[model samples]
Target: MIFAIETAALQTFDGAFADELFLVARILFGGVIAFIGLNHFLNLEEMAGYAEYKGAPAPTLSVGASGVVLVLGGLAVALGAFPTLAAGALAGFLVVATPMMHDFWAVPEDQRQDELNSFLKNVGLLGMTVLLLAVSTVEWPYAVGVGLV
Candidate 1:
């Protein structure tokens, strides 16, 4: 009985630490995503030009709309509000944009490496969003408690 109690106490301590770490992860991860979104606005002309070059219809509008989605979704993830939706939105954006924007195979040889790197990075972000989705249904410790499932 005493051993069991001691084990439980240790588990509680470890769980608290892990929970705090999760919060940190959310902050850093979401912050990067939000910053990327902001960059879309900051470099609007350049980004839109690239999008146009890639044959995106209404390139400027597409970039602006994506920027809004990224900023909102990233902020929600960071704030732990509407976690499932936020993660889902982020995942969806990645799924659509990664392939459309970073078609490394179709790019010229000179640009292929850069595009490949960008593609790989987006893939990594997508994986993280999926991970968040997997956990978003659960109550996150220290969350703002505004989640829908």
Candidate 2:
């Protein structure tokens, strides 16, 4: 497996080195999630306005609720707590939000590229979330699960 190969190749370093690397990766990833999620709160009014412009019903409430998900999911992911659920929640959030918020096809030519890029970035994040779901072995904190921090 690719992991096996990488681990074997990196055997020159202490095993803890690899663990620390992964830990850092998770922490950084989680930090990013937390940042964006927290941003939603910091710009609640503007975000809600934009959501309203996008035709999201009850934009204020929607933004508030989604922000909560992002913060919680990001925290859980960062801590490797219930990772599958956390990552899955993140993936699901991105999937629904990306299309609704980044409809590049609906934008003008000038804005299309930017929107498209946002959409693509969300896709990449979604892929990472799914990958986390697939590869993580930490157990669920509140229920049966698998994955390690």
Candidate 3:
């Protein structure tokens, strides 16, 4: 019985540690999104220029919309409010944007490295988003508050 109790206590500690790590990751990732979103608004012209260079249609409008989504979704994720939905939206956006906006595969070999890095980063982000969605469905702030529970 004592051994069982010790094991259970250890498990609880592990769970708490995992939760803390997850929260820290959520904050860092969300902060990056928020920063980039703010940059979109503050550097609207630069964002539009990048969009146009990427051959995106209606560069200005696209920049604006992406900026808004990033800002709102980032905040939602950071606060652990509606995390699942926010993560889903971000994943979807990355799916589309990675190929359309980044297009690392199409670049020259020398220049491709950076683009590939960006592409891989987006892929990782997508994975995180999906994981966050899964966790949100299983946990309190996300499940109960967001109705995923």
Candidate 4:
């Protein structure tokens, strides 16, 4: 199983169609992440209020900082620039924010399902971040070639 996983992780795409698909996926993924970050700014007051409700320290500052991280990281990923740093920022954000922002178990019964859905969505995104991290050492076929690795 370990070998299979390794093989899969190391697999490379070499065709035009595959390249386009990978590039499109990156753009879509990064676009959505960037949009989500932008949303933090657009909804700052509401998001800060929720953060305060969750007992986050310096809720306003935290939200703004996270928004910057997301915007920068998402753009890097989309542009294929500094993928390792970008992925790290994104993964870090998700790791910390997921539980704090979407703690279904801690929410009231009426909001539990909504929070659970968000938690699950974040988990899926976390999985994608891990995948990007795993491939950060490789030259991305359609990337802008701005990464140190």
Choose 2 or 3, whichever is better by lDDT. Answer: 2
Candidate 1 residue-wise lDDT, 1-149, digit = tens: 45543432122214548888988989989999999999999999999999998888899999998999899988888889999999999999999999999999998999999999999999999999998887887787678999777
What is the TM-score (0 to 1) of candidate 1? 0.88
2 or 3: which has the higher TM-score? Answer: 3
Q: Pick the candidate with the highest TM-score.
A: 4
User: Which digits, one per residue and each the tens of the lDDT, describe model 2 over residues 1-149?
Assistant: 35543433222224656556766777788788888899999999999999998788899998988898889888877787778778888988998899999999998899999999989988988887887786555332232333444
Q: CA lDDT of each candidate?
A: 0.89, 0.78, 0.78, 0.90
Better of 1 and 3 by lDDT: 1
Tens-digit lDDT track of model 4 for 1-149: 35543444555777769878878878888998999999989999999999999988999999999999998888888999999999988999999999999999998999999999999999999998888898888787779898776
Candidate 4 regions exceeding 4 Å error are 1-11
- TM-score per candidate: 0.88, 0.79, 0.80, 0.91
Clashing pairs counted in every model: 0, 5, 0, 0
Summing lDDT over every window of 10 consecutive residues in candidate 2, give the lowest-scoring window: 5-14
Reference-based TM-score, model 4: 0.91
Any runs in candidate 3 off by more than 4 Å, and if so which? 1-14, 140-149
Error of 2 at 54 (Å): 1.5
RMSD of 4: 2.4
**lDDT of model number 2:** 0.78
Candidate 4, residue 60: lDDT: 97
